[model samples]
Target: MLASLLDSMADSLVCSVELEKTKGITVRVYNESGKLTQTVILDGKSITIKSQGEQKSSTIIQKEDSIISEVKGSEQTSTITQKEDSVVIKCKSFQVDAETVSVKSSKDSTHESGGKLTVTSQKDMSLTSSAKAALKSTQAMDLETNANLTAKATQNVSLSGLNAELKGTTKASVASDTAVEVTGVKVDVKGKAQLTLEGAITSVGENITTVKGQLVKVEGALVKLG
Candidate 1:
């Protein structure tokens, strides 16, 4: 019976047995040189199996518990990007060259880093927007340290205003400072004006000072005050 079983083991083997009538069977398959290729050990209520080969280059499949797959080669993704562009990635060392790369999202996207993000350009770098733009900081610093806004127009650097307050092409500002100084060709005062003369001053206008009374008023033309 053993010799017949060995002679018929060349192609396949099939058996039907009830475990309650007989003990469990142990099936071990070997290569040509009697080396184990696969194993199957059947116990009363469980079966254990193990395959033999170089684990680094073998594909394992099991049927008992959870499956775990491991790949030692490269992999590819079905969807690279929502955008369409050509890119070159070098694997010999490490490098990436792309014509254009855009990062976009449906919602707001923010990029924050613990280190610094420095950008440098050679020929020209411009920041243009169709809408309004602003630059501000919430840190505590001096005027010079806080904001340094420098604009250089090569040909003509002139600032003109539309005189929004019904003035004639005038630009006026109300600055809150300790002291104010006016220097130009000529200073014009429209509203009721007052000046305190400390030293001997010369007059250049028609009415330098006016003295108001009940029904009469006096206007000084060439008055000297000390």
Candidate 2:
């Protein structure tokens, strides 16, 4: 049987099988260049198979109900297709270190982390969604930008909090197409150097209006005070 199997192979291929008292059986195949191309070791409990190509090497070990396989190469690609059910991998720790990695799903995909999960990019990162995207946090969420940060919406942009504040170191301006209203239990507007309120029509209405300054000057075409 072994001779017939060896005769079936190509002339450039050499096959040999060795039996050991303690190690069981080992079968090795050599290529034309006398390089070990394939090896199969079968013991009573497990079977290990290894294959080497010009640039790649693969090993598969099968024991009982579990099988482990590994492949190493400079440039390699792998494809797996499952007809039914799903494929699951469970381990104590799993990691992949590569120059680039990409994952694509036809329908929907989910990623869950028990502990902390972090993603970092050296250059730039962008996220786009066709419908809607939402982010929620139980505690607090913070967003900081070194250069600039911009938030734009087609319909409307709403921001609400228990306390909200907007500040600019140099200048800050608020413009509206129709009207701008500021209402609260108490409203305070102060300018460090000078304050200017200019509009086509400026109306100030309150229960009591008080104007006090070091030097009060009201310059207008017609100034009326009650």
Candidate 3:
């Protein structure tokens, strides 16, 4: 019935409505050139709509379990799929504005940004990895904490740089279980008030040792000079 109706209006502007017992109902529109420009199908299980333009096209399909919408142009294509459990969107660029948003993946997920990526949380933010995690920056990276910052490792922690300095406003301490050694071409240990060196055995200056003070006194159980 629909084929005969379409054949009757082949060269004219045609708008047809077909209702079939087995296939379902269909509505179609054709241009004067007999080119199909629009189509709509409504069945027991699904509904589909399609529109065609000179340089762009759009299609929408709605089913019992899913709905898909797609648009195509010369430069870009966009598609959206909505299912019972999930929703997926594909396009050239995407942006979202919401009070809260959450994303989860069962297996693995990856996100790539060509330009800059920034994440901001007003309250708190946390990231956890089951195995290992690494952070790298090509140019430079900066980390600042307003409150307190803590880092812990089970095995060992190492810090290396071309030049490194450690400072404390109130006090500073270096403690180890076995031994502590400071090696440099020249080392300076100074105290504003008093300086004390205590150990089981104290040894200073391999090549030469110098003691300078206004009043110098050497006190030991037995003082020996060579």
Candidate 4:
């Protein structure tokens, strides 16, 4: 049996130069120059591949069946997006490009969705102390981060009635120091027309309101308002 197996193997190689694999098989690819190209494994159903130059397994997709609203359909939705620092997934369409990546579900428009956008540095190199010591490499973007507008789902929009509560956390850090400084600004709206500021009120006609007010001047500024 061992001699026959080796003979079969020799015959198979003589037949075709390209590698042949079946399900539940593992295959590794090498470039013509003998560089590692990719490694793939078939786990009875799906094929997973780790490509060259990629940090992680580059691609993994599974095929399955699904049952929808009293009917059965092919379970055909899976997406992964890795932008600069964020990842988002929506539906059937999923794309990972240079800056922002998103995955969308084509089944339902308003169903569950996930999305992430990276608004910071795009450097691909990781910053390590030893690596930096060997080669003078500047530090990458600090982890300390903050977003200007952060809000949870609100029940309704406040036109001119009561104030809505907005809550979030913040962290601030420059460079070289691990300690972080945090600050927050809140615009609390409590009563009807209670919160008002006098910067430069620009409007079409006479803008007057009987409430807490400040001196109004709009003559010398570059832009004027009524």
Q: Highest lDDT among the candidates is held by which one?
A: 3
Quote model 4's TM-score: 0.22
lDDT, candidate 3, 1-226, per-residue tens: 9998898667676789999988799999878563448989998779999998777889999999999999999999999999999899999988889988888889889998888888888887899998999998878778789887778898989988889888878988899899788988778899999999988787766667788999988889988765
lDDT of 4 by residue, 1-226 (tens): 9999987665442111234355566666655343335666667665455555322224544434311111112454444544454455546655466766556664534433355434455564343443224322254433333434333434532323245333434533233234333333632335454533333443332355433447654445376333
Candidate 4 wrongly placed segments (more than 4 Å): 1-23, 32-35, 54-57, 65-226
Q: Predictions ranked by TM-score, top down?
A: 3, 2, 1, 4
Q: Give per-candidate clash totals.
A: 0, 0, 0, 14
Instruction: Please state every model's RMSD to the true fold in angstroms.
Output: 17.7, 9.6, 8.1, 21.6
Give, for candidate 3, the lowest lDDT window spanning 10 residues.
28-37
When 1 and 2 are scored with TM-score, the better candidate is: 2
The C-alpha TM-scores of every prediction are 0.25, 0.62, 0.65, 0.22
Model 4 root-mean-square deviation: 21.6
lDDT, residue 64, model 3:
92
> What value does the lDDT take at residue 74 in candidate 4?
49
lDDT (CA) for every model shown?
0.46, 0.79, 0.87, 0.44
Clashing pairs in 1: none
Q: Which structure is stronger by TM-score: 2 or 3?
A: 3
- Model 1, position 169, has a per-residue lDDT of 42
Q: Of 1 and 4, which scores higher on lDDT?
A: 1
Summarize candidate 2's per-residue lDDT along 19-131 as a digit string, tens digits: 99889999999886645489999987889898888788888778776666766676653322222455444445568999889999888878788889798889999988878
